[model samples]
Target: MSENPYSYVESELPRLLGNSSVSGVYKNKPEDFEVIEVLGFSPEVVEKGQQHWLRIRKVGVNTAAIEKQLSRALKIHPRDIGYSGMKDRMAVTEQWFSVQLPALQSMDWPAWFAEHMHAEVFPGGQVTLLEAVRSHRKLRRGVHKANHFRLRLKAVENADDLTQRVQQLVAGGAVANYFGPQRFGKHGDNVGQAMRMIQGEFQVRDRKLRSILLSSVRSFLFNQYLAQRIQSNLPYVNEGDVLILEGSQSYFTVSADDKDIVERVQSGDVHVSGPMFGEAPSPAKGRPAELEQHVLDQFPALYEGLCAARMGHERRPLWLRISDLALTWPEETVAELSFTLPAGAFATSVLAELGQFTEGEHANSTE
Candidate 1:
């Protein structure tokens, strides 16, 4: 393979690599998880009850499509429907949405939903009459808590045992935080477009339109970098370790060993994450390695994202974890798993692991 072009600026990259110290360690209108809550938030498993938050599954339809359907069905603004994250449409996806039909509480949801739409309702799903403020409250974004899930894929040659491998990282705090290539577009065409626009290469017959598109392109590229970090299992700087931050020129690779700052970085309490998207990839033999360099070259920012799976690393933030997985099958595949997670994690992340992941077909969705 070739060196991933996605990397930090040439002059900015570190000269050599060594073992990093073992460290502890959304979008739309969605707010971020609270600094304290994220580090310590972990909800206990619970049985279904009244007023419980629930997720509804709508297979086949994409997020955009579902949003349109939802808006039309309730005769409400598409904005009125709230979801914490966007589910993919081509594959089956489960999304959390609220509905308030006072008189319909006693009605059968399976029949009612079937009559109104084409998707099937799965178990572990919740349905409750919507509270008045729910309509006005923009569905909170960032997972209130996400349940991390594991899927074991077979068909691996001795060379590649991807299954169980991804799961092993969970114990070591290696999150699948990588921004998939989708964020970069094909060969990073979107990033390239933004580069041209940023360099003033675009014709301005319609300045406003051009600016908006260019901005979106930049954001996508950034998201790509973020995703790469998540996938790599980068370590957060903490306690005895050293770290660098590639901010503006004034603070390039600024290093410090302060425990407080390092811990803050590890917890992601003070600093969230930044994009390594602007950089190019590396010349490497494997997709995973090339991607790692793409992020590592970014350093500190991607640094946290680059930490690999190791023994003894504590999964911080008490992030999402699924235990007691029971796939119920009498009439349908009803997956019952206990979830304990931080306040801002995405439950869909767990669904993504279950396979057949799909986002609803909602055009207004801010995925």
Candidate 2:
């Protein structure tokens, strides 16, 4: 068997944007990378509620650090704090967090936190409270609608044709959806650690840590499957493709005789998806199945380990659509970019196609 073409790190992965010539520096400072979380629905404040949902903007801090600070300040258990997703540690991010306070206790914690933020007392970085609401339920994972990114790439080199590259991406409408390097941990070590855990060499007692490892393994395989499709020059809409409905998780398999599959894909009514491997058999058949199996065959141990762990079956779209993409150059060597992506998509994946980037000093830390 041939060695896998896709690397665990995202930058080494095949780019659908063609040649990778542009080189730049990423996240030079916290201000250079900004993300604004957009929650779909507004939570109403209730008179008798324990959950305090707060929207906060933090510079140079990860989501968990804020949760820990809140727990310490409120004298509550760490589990009492909840968040939708983990925001990057080295960036300026605005996100929501919910703290479950005692229903009978009325301490005005939000006001207290806002004051502390203004006082700049927190150790990690500066945090400012944007909005706060009282609710009865805790915030859950994957609840955010989307994230808007504002990025500034410094010391950009060989970017004379950057505009044309962005145009090509805009004309193509989508980029190959690969998990960001952050997902695989520093230097893409999570997948290797997951394999050790699978082989009984590493024992993980923490449930959260165990889940992260499993997820990394699954993500690695998914990237491999997507890479194979791209390398083969396969069209997004193809026979036996498992199509995911637009704006939904629901999916259905298309038969070879399905005449309208192309139209549905082009109309943005559906998307071609790749297997999220687990114990359950893949619904893909024909060429799609062949492609998935080819990837699975390359890593039988990883495949069997996932099955033994009984990971849930899921599907992620093979293509990611970039929305409201805009770019501007502040100087000859500096580029500013802004775009919005649906929840669970990575801005780094989009950036990988635009240029090869070296992480700035602070960006080396884990989120």
Candidate 3:
């Protein structure tokens, strides 16, 4: 077996605010990190429907584990359990889930779940049903609009310095949209697995697991490209860059001479995009394209494997805007931060710009 070309090391990436002397600890307890899922649209309600939508608040529980519990209690196929995205097992998080039952059939699901899956009796952690509604549609992944985060950093080495860093990020209104450590799995074994899969060392028959491994490959490549862009001090936009319109996925390439494009980017109407690495050629041109190609050439196995697997081309914004960012000192050695991030963005990315933070037990994962 060959050495994996991509070894995800968090320290290797440059922080926008540079290194800080401050350090802190987070996820020390379940309450230290909280996430609330924001849905894009409210599920349509019906008196009796095949789909049951539930809003749940859970503490120190894996989202998948909850799905299994529901499956057994409801006696439904595991595939019938649907969630927008995975929430961290170590944090206190509230998110939605959907279970499909026979059309027009009903059972007192809330009471059933309350009796069988209450927080006190739940095996691994606590789960409380917040709301229940009947809907015609089953919840799907990536349907949530955003995630609101409340984080408390304990044992802060230098709260004042951390405050300055937060100010810097708030001023910029954005941070590098790096996929947090969660995406690569523990110690980047996911990327290593992807490499092995590419070499035919093994095959992944499970579709969900397969998608994760492939996504790790693509995320790894994007991080590499973004890291180089930061190192080179490349502007978010450059000639031959692909720019995505705000609030939409539609994107188009632009030339350096497109003077109006720069103003738009500055106004947050368009964002510079980076490749997700798939079968189609990268839409980037000029310097951006050159930098991306440099990153791709170093990972032949990953690139070729993704193409062979037929992953479609996609682009993610190079910058993630932080909304309603606020910070407060709760104690001499503690600081709290609250912010809202659009769907698919990681809160840890914001914390990365401030100081070195150590996680407690299971607190490192994102919801």
* Candidate of highest lDDT: 3
Measured by TM-score, how close is model 3 to the native structure? 0.95
Task: Name the runs in model 1 displaced over 4 angstroms.
Answer: 1-54, 99-111, 119-138, 150-154, 159-176, 182-188, 192-257, 260-272, 275-367
The true-versus-predicted C-alpha distance at residue 263 of model 2, in Å, is 2.3
- Minimal lDDT window, size 10, model 1: 24-33
Better candidate number, 1 or 3, judged by TM-score? 3
Candidate 2, 99: how far from true, in Å?
Answer: 1.0
TM-score of candidate 1 to 2 decimals: 0.44
Ranking 2 against 3 by lDDT, winner: 3
RMSD of 3: 2.2
The segments of candidate 3 whose C-alpha lies over 4 angstroms from its true place after superposition are 1-5, 362-367
Instruction: Compose the digit string of candidate 1's lDDT tens values, residues 1-367.
Output: 2254433221122111212221110111111111111212222322232122324544334455555666686577755555565443323344455443333234345564566554343222222222122122244555444433222212222212222332443443333222333333334354455445445577446654454444344344344444553445654432222222322111111134343675544444433334322333222223433543464454433222222211111111212233333222122222222333333333334433333223222211222
Q: Per-residue CA lDDT of candidate 2, range 1-367, in tens?
A: 2243333655557878776778898898889999999988888788679988999998888887788788887789988898998898788999999989878877565579766554356556788888888899899999899999999999888876677778776775678889888788876778888888888997999998999998988999999988888889987688888999988989999896889888888778998999999999999988999999998999888889889888877999998878888889989999998989889888888888887877897685456
User: What TM-score against the true fold does each predicted structure earn?
Assistant: 0.44, 0.94, 0.95
Task: Mark the regions of model 2 whose C-alpha exceeds 4 Å error after superposition.
Answer: 1-7, 114-121
CA lDDT, every model vs. true structure: 0.35, 0.84, 0.86
Error of 2 at 88 (Å): 0.8
Error of 3 at 12 (Å): 1.9
- Any idea what lDDT model 1 has? 0.35
